[model samples]
Target: MSRKAHSFLHEYPRIRVDRFTESRERVPDFLLPPRCRAGAAKRQDEDEDDDEPGPWDDLDQDDESTLKANGGVRFFPAPTIQLLSHIHADHIEGLSAPLRSSAPIYCSAATKEMLMRLESQKSREKGACRVPMGEGARKRPYEWLRVTAKHAKAKKKFTGLAPAPRDLLHALPFNTPTELRYSPGVNIRITLLDANHMSGSTMFLIEGHRGAVLHMGDCRAETWWIEA
Candidate 1:
């Protein structure tokens, strides 16, 4: 019964492909998922047992192929800031050494801890020293700004991970709207909210001269801790 209901919910949308396409056309600025672009590599490995095709396989060839391809982080040439919503591998895939070293990354404290742990583990596997060192010897690949809830308590110091530059990690309390002064008399106000997805997931509300945009990272409408 569950399988049938799932199939119905999934396949019913495809049955009205024409209406969906028309609706999509009305929103010109809408961003397409990474996989919808042409030349996107299949994420599944051949060794996996499941062989079922995905629901989107039936999309029109042209519609699926023509969208501009995007990486994990969208790049704007002028006055660009990188906001990391979470620490999921998929969201952080394009955060290579070059990109990490070049830009400032804004994320939550929990996400930062996860990233540091992952990096530390990799360094250990590579035969690098596991002992935490000073900023000059062992700094994060990028400048990390931690956004935390206002009511949340201060995090305990973690000594297992490598040390990040003291100047690199800045913690911003939630509910306190902060302004990023990009230029003289020009700034952007940003607020953070609990995402209800996982530990440290966040939703960002950005306001500037142009307009306000709420970027919701991977979030769940119903929190996991709530009783169903």
Candidate 2:
């Protein structure tokens, strides 16, 4: 379920978490115990006629609550360069302050748009005015800003997906490898592969002295790009 790539035998040079899912399809819905169903049926009968909708109109309410309470994430190992596919909470909740303190993030234009939309909605709900996005996630709130600060202080660069070719200057150079000095005489190379799953979802191709690894975040195996 998890894989790692290390180029050298060094102290914490770099580690990449690969492939959150085999594909971008929905996982199985959680199934409650039979007792829950029985209890719901009883409550339904008492609250409304058999033909009426049950009091618990949505069985997945608990699931959604659990996700939100848990920051709406299904966390996998973190990636060196994360390419988000969409703005779904489950796909992105882990992108909170703590998680982002570790690595630079990349995503598709559509995905960023969706995330901005959600942030705008949250701002409206909290009665906060919307602020413009910065050059990268660095300009974002706590998690993003902190992470960006760390990279900036270290003279590291953070890249993001561009909505258009015009956005290229503002975006992180995609499909390029950057050298990281994890430790003395230890270095690593990280490359990005476009994952068609979402606007900016990506598959990582990491090469090091140890070995080469490819990680698909949420991608179609049969995609034509795979052949290309």
Candidate 3:
């Protein structure tokens, strides 16, 4: 069965796609991301299996494409801050671009701990988003072809996993509110509430001068979220 969801939540959800599995780990034989640190020539052997499953292989549509259709993260310019609810691959499509940018990323402490387990953000793309991500539902052409263990070892520069930069990741406390002073006039109060979806799953309660908006990033609950 697919993972349970906070189906009623229609507010600001980061990832809107309904998933086939609870998390990225459920995909069997999950290979490294279908990306290379540098561009490579297309596969030489005609018989070579280019369809090998990568981390997001199981996903039919990608988050960025969904974002493009739904009109959110991918289309909007750099947000005030980046917030990650969890480390699931679906929630992280088009992730490399944000990681490469200077925008700070915020999440619960658990999410930060797990970022190390994800593919390293170091990549070949240059300058501030010279090429936009989410151009393809699957891997971008530059992020083309799955990086198998054999391919990774053969390609000396491909290190699938590495430590996220400390300065870029921000861990916020659940329940307690934190203030983001973007400018003298632009300030926002953000509070993280437990979504009870997973170890670090959360919903964002963002309050500004105009109003309060709750962003429920992929979650699976009905009511207790408001109590948080």
Flag the better candidate by lDDT, 1 or 2.
Answer: 1
Candidates ranked by TM-score:
3, 1, 2
* Shift of residue 42 alpha carbon in model 1, Å: 41
Better TM-score candidate (1, 3): 3
lDDT of 3 by residue, 183-222 (tens): 3455677898887888887788877653577877677876
C-alpha lDDT of all candidate models, in order:
0.44, 0.41, 0.49
Residue-pair clashes per prediction, in order, are: 0, 2, 0
RMSD of each: 16.2, 17.5, 20.5
Error of 2 at 134 (Å): 18
Question: Which residue runs does candidate 1 get wrong by more than 4 Å?
Answer: 1-75, 100-103, 120-169, 223-228
* Winning candidate number (lDDT): 3
lDDT of 1 by residue, 37-154 (tens): 3344656544342344433332333422234443222221222244566666655543433333333456677766766545434445444655565543444443233324321222
TM-score, each model? Answer: 0.44, 0.40, 0.45
Model 1, CA-based lDDT: 0.44
Candidate with better lDDT, 1 vs 3: 3
- Candidate 3 matches the true fold with a TM-score of 0.45
lDDT for each residue of candidate 2 in 39-64, tens digit (9 for 90 to 100): 23335335334334331222223464
